[model samples]
Structures are given as C-alpha cells and as structure tokens.
Target: MSTGAFSDTGLFVCFEGGEGGGKSTQSRLLQQWLEADGHEVVLTFEPGDTEVGKRIRQIVLSPETGELSNRTEVLLYAADKAEHVDTVVLPALRAGRVVITDRYVDSALAYQGAGRTEAVAEVEAVNRWATRDLRPHLTVVLDLAPQAGLGRFEERDRIEGESLEFHQRVREAFLAMAAADPDHYLVVDARGSIEEIHAVIRARVAAMLVTA
Candidate 1:
C-alpha cells in the first residue's frame, strides 16, 4: 500500500492511539523538544484546530449531539480534516516548520472506521482526499489497553464513552496499521513512565531529524 504524500519542506509527525493514551502529553513534549533545538514547530490537532473544525468537533464529540449516522460522522470528521489542512497544516509545512499533530487521518480510520465498524477502505479513501493525501513522516502509536486508557479520564466525550469492545477494536486498528508500515510508525507501551516514553519517541524522532 502507498504511504501517501509526505512534505518535502518540513517534518510531519503524528501521535495516535485510543482515548487517553497520552497523545496530548507526548505531542506537547515533542513540540517543546523540537522548539528547544531551534526548529520552528507547529502543534495542532484534528477536528478542532481550525475555526470551521471547532464546530465540527463540537457536533461530533459532544454527548449532547447524541448518536449520528456512522457515515455522517466520517464525513464530518473529513470536513474538519479538509478545513484543517487548507488553513493550518499545509501552511506550516510549506514554510519548513515541523508540524506535530495530535491526531490525523489514522484517528478517523481507527475510531470512525474500526471503532464504529464502518468500512475501513471507505474511511481511508475519504480522509486521504480530505487532507489532500498528506501523510505523516512518522506516526507514534501509544499502545495501551482500552480499559487502562479509559480509566485515565474522569469525564468522557462521546467517543470516549464507547464500550470496551469498541475501544479494543480501535486499538487493534492502530496496531494493524502500524504493523503494516513499520518505517513510518513507532509503537510505544503507554504504561511506561512519561519520561521514558518521551525518551523513546525523541530517539526515533532524533534519527529522523538527521535525515530531515
């Protein structure tokens, strides 16, 4: 399978996993580390990074919205991806800034595709087009049991409140994708100490920087 398009001007890294897998923490740490090294870095997230995406994120993540059609959810997420790429991601990357995203196309494929039991191929196609086929140079998957991850959160979003089985499927989806593309992925045991996990991620990113 194709790895999709990667930027030639800048580095693109993404963090992926089930809910509460410390994607935010790791993404922040990576951004800080990159900035400290004198690299211009842009930290962003999907479904709400742009003005238009914020509304889409509210409708998709808010419990008050109740259930939506599985296909509807995919398109909403895709719309956010479209807006985000056009308004934020592409701009930074073209400017040679490191772009670290909390989640990207993989999240939609795992959560809306596998978690919701939607057609994975269809989800991938929509997202590929949504982001203009932009792919991260490296994706860090924080491997963790769904139970452990869910317990980390006191409050739940709509997606977070999903059943254990649902999250299990999502977790599997991330692993399967990573396994298929080892060169573009790093799977981390999220149960490790925060600093340890960050060290592992930084080491991998460090190597990529030598080439970047």
Candidate 2:
C-alpha cells in the first residue's frame, strides 16, 4: 500500500460515504468556494467522468445489467477509475488545480469490499493500483445511517437496491477507513443542515490551504 503525498502545488480532495450522503452537493460547494478565492478548480466524479467512464458507469449502475459477479463488478469500477485518472484527474492536478471529486477509490473499498463481502484489503490494493497510488489530500466522509440515507433517494441504482445489511456494512467500512486515517479524513455527521456541513468542511479546507 503506497501511502504518500500527492502533488505539492495541487490539492486532491475526495468526498465519500454511503448513498445520498450529499457528497455531490458538498463537492460542488467546495469547488465554487475555491474558484471564488482565485484558485483553479476541477470538479469531477468517478465511474462517469470521461467518455469511456460514462459507458462504464452505465453498465455498473444500471439495474438492467443484473447479477454481475463480485470480481467482475470490481474490475469494471477499477477500469473506470483507471481511465478517469488518466484522462481527467491527473492532468488537472498536474496543472495545479484543486481537484474536488464526488467519489474516489474509497467508494470502491467501501461498496465492493463491504457490500459484496470481499476482502477490504484486497479491494484497497486493487483501487490503489488502478489509481496509480494517488492519495487524496483530504477525504471527507459524510457519515449517515443507511436507512436514513437510502430513504432520501427516490430511485435506487443497482448498488442502492442492495439489502439494508449490505448498506450498513458499507457504512461501517467507510467509518473504519476514516478511523484508521484520521489525519487524512474528516468524518462528518450527515444529519446536520447543509450549511452546517459546508461550514465545517470549509474550515478544514481553509486550514489546509493556509499550510499548503
């Protein structure tokens, strides 16, 4: 496992958690704030960032694709990440842009590892290699219970349609990963108001900016 620093001139921040945790909302908010502060920001997401990734995303998320094997699903996600980093993420980071992602490798670790009952360590290894060992400067996990989070979604995707037990495992996996790396993670309770969550996120990123 390669746990090292990312680009010195650029910041790669990833938002992670179970479904309907408001990761997209927070990622966009952070991007807007960074841009307003005169920083070049790239807002992106995994499993659908690039042209190839779009097709991969459709296959992975569509319920019609039905009953994929665990290994096959993991490979599809890894493929998306490989193409995403090569085309969208790495270039933006190289250009000294603040890359704010809605989801990253951690999603794979939590969803595939825990939800599918696979080895978490192996999942992490695959994702790390898929992303070329790129580590986010900060990973913000919007922690919420599976029942409440899933209830917020009117329509569920293939993964979201999973059993509540699966989602609970996924949530625990995310929390465990965050707990293992506190310095690199900000675990926020998602029950808070949108503005309240953004405020805490802003404070953390502000502290990083001062030191960066």
Candidate 3:
C-alpha cells in the first residue's frame, strides 16, 4: 500500500518484550523487511537517540548504583520516553517513515508502570500527556516465560540483573496490556527460532498494511 494514498505520512509500529526476548533481533528484521518493501524506515530504541537519553540510559542501565527506588526508576524511564518522543518518534512519523522502535512507551508501562513501582494507570496517564496521545498503529509483543527471557538476559550487562520476581512482574504487566487492547496489540510466542519469529512478524505487518 502506498502511504501516499493515506492521509498520514507513515505508520508507527512498536516491538515490545521483556529482557532476553528477541525484541532487538526481531526489531532489526522488521526494519529491514519494511525497507525492502519500499517504505522509508527509521529504527530507534528506548534509552533513545538523544543526548539526554544517552545519559539517562547509562544511569538506568548501570548496575553500579546500589539500589534505585521503584518510583524514581519509573520517572527516569518516563523522562527518557518524553524526550525520545519529542526528538525521535514524532518527527519520523510526520516525515512519512515507518518507525520501528525496539522498545517504546509500553516498556515503561510494563517494566516500571505495573511491574516495578508506580500504578499502571498513573504510568499510562503520564505517558499519554507526554506523547500527546500518540500511539503505535500496531504493537507486536514478544511473549515468553519470564524466567526463560531473563535467563537470556543474564549474559548481557544491565538491569536484567534484577530479581526473578521483578522480571515476573514485567511479564505479567505485558500480558495484561495485551489483554486489554486486543485490537492494537498482537502477542507472539517468542520461544521459537529467529527465522520463524521474523516470518510471523512479516506476515502480520503485511496484513496490517493491507487492512490499513
């Protein structure tokens, strides 16, 4: 479908998942696939592409800090998101590019909103204000067992080092979000081979474009 036919310049799609889930890999594949199909594409990630974002990313992801309070952590993530939306996502959408984010507002919703400290409603409320009600056209959630996902995260450096219970909360939060918004979200089993997962994502994107 030519974006020229639609009133909007481009589409917004987000890939969301817990640590160890194949979000990064799948996000890359989707961006490549979209570009191959002739759509202009912008690939961005949370902890984002801005200078403030980079500083915030180092602070949040570093385990060197003894213990970060839940609300503080939540607010930090939200701050990063607000800057990211202002500087990255909104512009790409306005310019008619398919914007693929490795993580988005939903990550804060899951990891910090419902899972870590703040109330889900409060987290979402702040996000709504920050984004000015902007949302993804499709959110592909990579679902896997929390333990399985965290296991994959252990080798990497970062907050995936959090307690198992904390990660479980993250998974539960993601599931709840998907359950509540079946129309805009699709849950994909991410326990499979990379190729298989990418194939599923490609099919979904194709169908969504057709229907759009």
Predicted structure with the largest TM-score when compared to the true one: 1
Better of 1 and 3 by lDDT: 1
Model 3 Cα displacement at 36 (Å)?
A: 1.0
**Best by the lDDT measure:** 1
Q: After superposition, how far is residue 146 of candidate 2 from its true place, in Å?
A: 0.6
Candidate 3, residue 11: how far the Cα is off, in Å:
0.7
Ranking by lDDT: 1, 2, 3
lDDT of each: 0.94, 0.92, 0.81
Candidate 1, residues 17-103, lDDT tens digits: the string is 998789999999999999999999999998799889999999999999998999999999999999999989999999999999999
Q: List runs of model 2 lying over 4 Å from the truth.
A: none
Ranking by TM-score: 1, 2, 3
* Model 1 per-residue lDDT at 9: 93
TM-score of each: 0.98, 0.97, 0.91
Clash count list over all predictions:
0, 0, 0
Residue 178's C-alpha lDDT in candidate 2? 94
- What C-alpha lDDT, on a 0 to 100 scale, does residue 123 get in candidate 2? 85
